[model samples]
Target chain A: MTCQELLDLLHDYVGNELVIESRTTVEVHISGCLQCGTLVHAYTHTVRVARALPKCNPLPAAFEARLRAMIEPELKDKPAE
Target chain B: MFDPPPEKLTPEIVFREYAPRIYNIARRMLGNDADAEDVTQDVLLQVVRKLDTFRGDSQIATWLHRVTVNAALAHRQKRANRQKHESAEADDDVLGSGGPVTPGKRWEVGPEESVLAAEQAAIIEKAIEQLPEPFRDVYVLADVEGLPNNEIGEMLGLSLAAVKSRLHRARLRMRDLLAPHFEGKVTS
Candidate 1:
């Protein structure tokens, strides 16, 4: 597998979506190609960092209050009918 | 595949259960607290009004996902229109820019770097916000929400291949945006 071929398959490789035969070919190529290996590492790290992004902070109290207020009118309009 | 039908949901139940998640998706997509809040309210209201129409054909979460995405997209369109009307020149500049400006902070190589996490998160958030809408949606749903490609495709009405393609492109863009900070950190 050439560098460009490996690059094209990087996403599938990282995603584990490649079939066994193709996966083996890419792995063999990456294992020997320093540049391609580094590229894969960086790509994987990029995914890891993105996945590690801070979880969404809880909604602000003020915003929650506002949301409740907004819902109240709707609730009132439908009163247990 | 015979799965049990989704349970009937009440407005209060939907609000209590889904509000936080819905708000999170909106915030990530809209990149503004106020706009996200508005979307949350608008989408929840939509759910309440349309509850009777929900036939249990899909999970409640999937239904909410569709509604929230639509509402967020609409909100974005309205904001874009208003900005365009207010100042065509400003709109042109913002629209013309491919991505947010690279963060100004320089990277260093040690314990001092711990302080940079918050800034790094902010920069990533901005970079995400700058992604074109379609890619942004897939990235947030896939990477941030941890949804599978199949579910993302179902939610976005895209094919599985399309979801994977968009996600790959989105990840590559995010990597480029963040490469400066990760320099020296990633190695062979």
Candidate 2:
């Protein structure tokens, strides 16, 4: 792959989201091109950092109870079969 | 056997299944805890109110995200309108404390990492946040949420080419923004 083409594919490449042939070409380019290689490293590091944000509990246990109560008004008077 | 209509739209089911992903997207889009929680709640409430309309043609997550983006956009609009009317009000009152709430600087790093990694991450988040909505939406969905381009296209109702273009531009812009911190990691 040319430098520009490889650079364009670098995002997907580092995400490991690229197709096999494209990945091979990216690897080939990275093997010989120091500049493209650094770009790939930066992209990979960025993806790692983005993914590493702490996954917190999105809501408390009581939230479900609260949400159920809030939504129940819409369900009132439905035939209780 | 004929079936009776459903008794209720269960927030429990939706919350259990979808809340984490919804919160993740909200955090990325809205960039704060309170707003993300509010957006998450609003999206779930909308789901409950509109469950019957969910014809199930697409994945539930995509439909939920459409509700999310809509709700967030509405909230932003409302906030903007209020700000316009209160242009003379104390900026602190509008901002809810002081000069832009500082984002947490620390990463949940493994015990062995160096300071360089943390600095890189901070730079990257700043860069991601600076991207315009269309590009940021596709970038977060694809890169952060790990969705495929096809699914991202479906979620945003864009063509694959359009998604690719936005994603590429988002990355390029981010690379430029991050160049200072990532100096050794990219060539000019």
Candidate 3:
């Protein structure tokens, strides 16, 4: 494969989204091409770093309370005569 | 255990299991604490109201992500409308001014890798926040949430190929945005 084609497939390859036959082709290309190899390595590294972000945004109290208020009436009114 | 049927959408169970993930998706999509919180509330409330209609065609989290993205987009639309109507003023604030910019500064990690990882994540988040809503929504759902292409396609009401195409462009844009930082890391 050419450099552009390899780069285009880099994300899919790193994320394990490629089918076996396609992945084998890409792997073979990377094995011989230093440029494609670096792109894949860096692309994979970037994805890993992005995934490491701290998922830490707690919902606001008022929002939760409002949601509870909206649902409470429904819960109370359900299953009643 | 797997999620119970949608009719049994208990807030306690939902909050216990899915809230964190929901919050993460919202934060990535919206980039603000208040908006993320509002979207999370909206998603859960939506779950409560719409539970009976869920057909269990996809994973519960995938379903929840669809709700979450819709809620976040709705919130953004409302804000945009408000801005248009009032000719709203822009806030002259710097990044990291909203919520805790970093997660768990108290948590430990290997020094060099952690610093590089943190910087890389910040760059990515900024680039992601700048993407137009259509692509941004798909990117967050697919990459950040790590949902399958089929599931993402279902959530967005797109064909699987469409999801893959949008995701590919999103990745390319992200790579371009972060190329500066990957200088030493990538060989070519």
Best by DockQ: 1
**Per-model i-RMS in Å?**
7.3, 10.2, 10.2
**Higher-ranked by lDDT: 2 or 3:** 3
Choose 1 or 2, whichever is better by lDDT: 1
- Over B83-107, each residue of candidate 1 has an lDDT whose tens digit, in order, gives 8743211111222322322322222
Chain B TM-score of candidate 1 stands at 0.65
lDDT score for candidate 1 against the true structure: 0.70
lDDT of 3 at B3: 36
TM-score of chain B of each: 0.65, 0.58, 0.65
Colliding residue pairs in candidate 3 = none
Off by over 4 Å in 1: A54-56, A77-81, B1-13, B50-58, B83-120, B186-188
Ranking by DockQ: 1, 3, 2
| lDDT measured at residue B139 in model 1 versus the true structure, 0 to 100 | 85
Candidate 3: where are CA atoms >4 Å away? Answer: A15-21, A54-57, A60-81, B1-9, B49-59, B79-121, B185-188
Which prediction has the highest lDDT against the true structure? 1
**CAPRI classification of candidate 1:** acceptable
| Stronger candidate by DockQ (1 vs 2) | 1
The alpha-carbon deviation from the true structure for residue A19 of candidate 2, after best TM-score superposition, in angstroms, is: 6.5
In candidate 3, what are the lDDT values of residues B1-188, reduced to their tens digit? Answer: 12333544454555555666677788887777788877876776666555445444346655676778778777877887877853122221312122211111111222235334555567778888876566667778766666678877786677886676666666555555566655553223
